[model samples]
Target: MGAVINQFVINISLIFLFMSLTFYVMRTVLPIQRTSPLFVRFWFGVSNGLTAILLTINAIELGEARIDLRLIPIALSATYAGPFGAIVTLGLIFIGRMTIHGMSAPFVDAILMFIVFFLFSLVVSRVLINRVKGYAVYIGFGALLVLIQVTGSVGTGVFFNVFVPYFLMLSLGAWLCYWAAKKLETHLWMFLLHTHRATIDELTGLPNRYRTLEQMNDLEMSGKPWTLLVIDVDHFKQLNDTYGHLAGDAALRHIGQTLERNCPPSGFVGRYGGEEFLLVIEGSEDAKEVAEELVQTVRHTMFECQGEVIPMTISIGAAVAGHESSMVVFERADEALYVAKRSGRDQVRFA
Candidate 1:
C-alpha cells in the first residue's frame, strides 16, 4: 500500500513538472499561435512522447501487476496536438513496453489496447467540443482503461491495498493538469492583450507615434525606397474653438480612417501626434501623387457630429528618404510642412 502511494505521488509529480516547463516555454519563448507548426508539433508531440516513455520505465510492481502513468501524457498529447500527437506518444509507449517486458502476451495486449485508444482519441480530436468536454472524454477514458487493466489481473489483497489508492491519486492528477493548462492559457491571452494595447493608439485605432519612430529606424537599413509625408490638420485650433474638443476628436478619427482607406498597399499611416499624422510609403517617385491623393481625399470627406457639419483639410510635406539618417529625413519633412502651412494650408509641398 505504501509503495503504491509513493509511486502514484512520483508519477503525478513528474507530470506536474513537465506542465510547468511547458508553461514557461509558452510564456517566455514561443508565441503560441504565432509559433511555427513544426516546432509546435515537436514540443507537443515528441516531447510528450518521451515523457510517456519515461513514465513507462518507472512502472511500479505490486504482487502480479506492474503499472505506470503513461496514459496521462498520451491523453494530454492528444488534447493539445490531435491525431499526430496521439500516434507519436502511443508508438513510443509501445516501444518502451517491449523493451521492459520483451516478446510476451502483455506486449500483444498493449498493442490492441493502444489501437483502440488511438482511434478513440482521433474521434475526440475531430469533434467540435470545448476544452472541458475534450479533457473529460479523453482523460476519463484513459482512467477507465487503466482501472480495467488491473481489475482481474491483480491478487485480491493487491487489489484492495494498491489499486484503490492509485485510482484516487490518478483522478486528482488529471484534475491538476486540466487546471494548470487553463491557467497558462489565460496568462497567454492577457499577455497578448497587454502587448496589443501598448503598441496601438486607442483613439485613432492605428499604430501610435512611438511605433512609427521604431519603424522609421528599421526602414533606414532595409535598402528599400522610402518616402515620409508629414501632415497637419489645417485650422484645427479654430475648429476646436468654434465647436468643441469632442468635435475635434471626431474630426481626427474621421481623417485617420480616411487616410488609412486611401493609403497604398505598401504605405503605412500612423498618428504622429495631436493634429498630425505621418505616412511612410515605399517609392522614390517624389511621393507627390500619393500626397496629393491623400489631400484630396481628406478634403472631400465631410465630418459630421451631433447633426453639425465640420469643414476639414490637411497640409502635407513630402520628403524622399535618400542615403540619409531617419533624423535628417524627419527634419526635411518638418521643414517642408512649415513651407506648406506658411504658403496657406490645404496643399502639398516637397522637401
Candidate 2:
C-alpha cells in the first residue's frame, strides 16, 4: 500500500508538471490566438491522450489490481475540453492497456469498465452544469472506478487495503492537480487582462496615448515612409461646456469608433490625447486623401446621447514621414492641425 500510494502521488505530480509545461510552451513559445476552435480542441485532445498513455505505463500492480490514476486525465479532459478530448484519452488508454495485457481477461475487463465509465460520464456531463458540479460528480466516479478495479483484482486478503487508499489518493490527487492547474490558469489570464487594459483606453476602446506613441516611435525607427494625421475635435471645450462631462466622454467614444471603423487596412487609429486622435499610416502616400475622407465621415455622422443628436466635426493635419524623428513629425502635424482649426473647423491641412 505504501509503495502504491507513493507511485500514485508521483503520477499526480506528473499531471501538474504536464499542465504547467504545456501552458508555458503555448503562451511564451507559440503565442497562438487566432486559430480555429477545432484545431485547438484537437491539440488539447492529443495532449490529454499522451498524458493517459504515460499514466498507464506507470501503473502499480498490487497483486492482480493494476491500479493507476489513468481515468483522472480522461475526467479532466472531458471537464475542460469536452467529449472529443475524453474520447481521445480513452483511445490512448485502450492502446496502452492492450500493449500491457495482450489477449487477456484483464484487458477485457478494463475495456468493459471503461465503456461503463464513459457512458456514465456522458450522463454526468449532461446533468452537471459547471466545473464545481462536475467535481462533486467526480468523487462518485472515482469511488466506482475503485470498486470495479478491486472487484476484478486483489485476492480477498488485500481488497480492503487497496480499495480505501486507492480511492482516497485518486480523489485527492485529481482535485489537487485540477485546483493547482486552474489557479495558475486564472493568474495567467488575469495578468494578461491587466496588461491588455494598460495599452487600451477604458472610455474609447482605443489604444491609449502611451501605446500610440510607442507604435509611432516603432514605425519611425524602421526608417520607412509613413503618414501621420493629427485630428482634433472642433469646439470640444464648447461641447463639454454645453453638455456634461459624461456626454463629452460619450462623444469621444463615438468619434473613436467612427475613426476605427473607417481606418485603412494598413493604418492604425488611436486616441492621442483628450479631444484629439492620431492616425498612423505606414507605407502609403495618401495621407491627404484619408484625412479628407475622415473629415467628411465625421461631418456626416451624428453623436446621439439621451435622445439628443449633435452634429460633430474634426480638423485633421497630415504629415508624410521624412528623415526626421517621430516627435518632430508629430509636432509638425500638431501645428498643421492648429492651422486647420484657425482657417475653419472641419478642414484637413497638410504639412
Candidate whose TM-score is highest = 2
Q: What number of backbone clashes does candidate 2 have, counting pairs of residues 3 or more apart or in separate chains? A: 0
Give the per-residue lDDT of model 2 (tens digit) for 1-351.
Answer: 588767877798778877776555544323222132656546665676777788778876666666677767777766665666666667777887788678698788778877776777677666637775675575567577668666856566676666666677777887787787678767677777787799998999999998899989999889889999999999899989999899899999999999999999989999988999999999756777888999999999988987999989999988888999999999999999999999987999988
lDDT of 2 at 271: 93
What TM-score does each of the candidates earn? 0.68, 0.81
Off by over 4 Å in 2: 1-10, 21-43, 58-67, 95-108, 128-130, 157-165, 221-224, 306-308
Candidate 1, residues 65-91, lDDT tens digits: the string is 666777777777777767677787788
lDDT per model, in order?
0.80, 0.78
lDDT of 1 at 68: 70
lDDT of 2: 0.78
What value does the lDDT take at residue 162 in candidate 2? 62
Ten residues in a row with the worst lDDT in model 1? 27-36
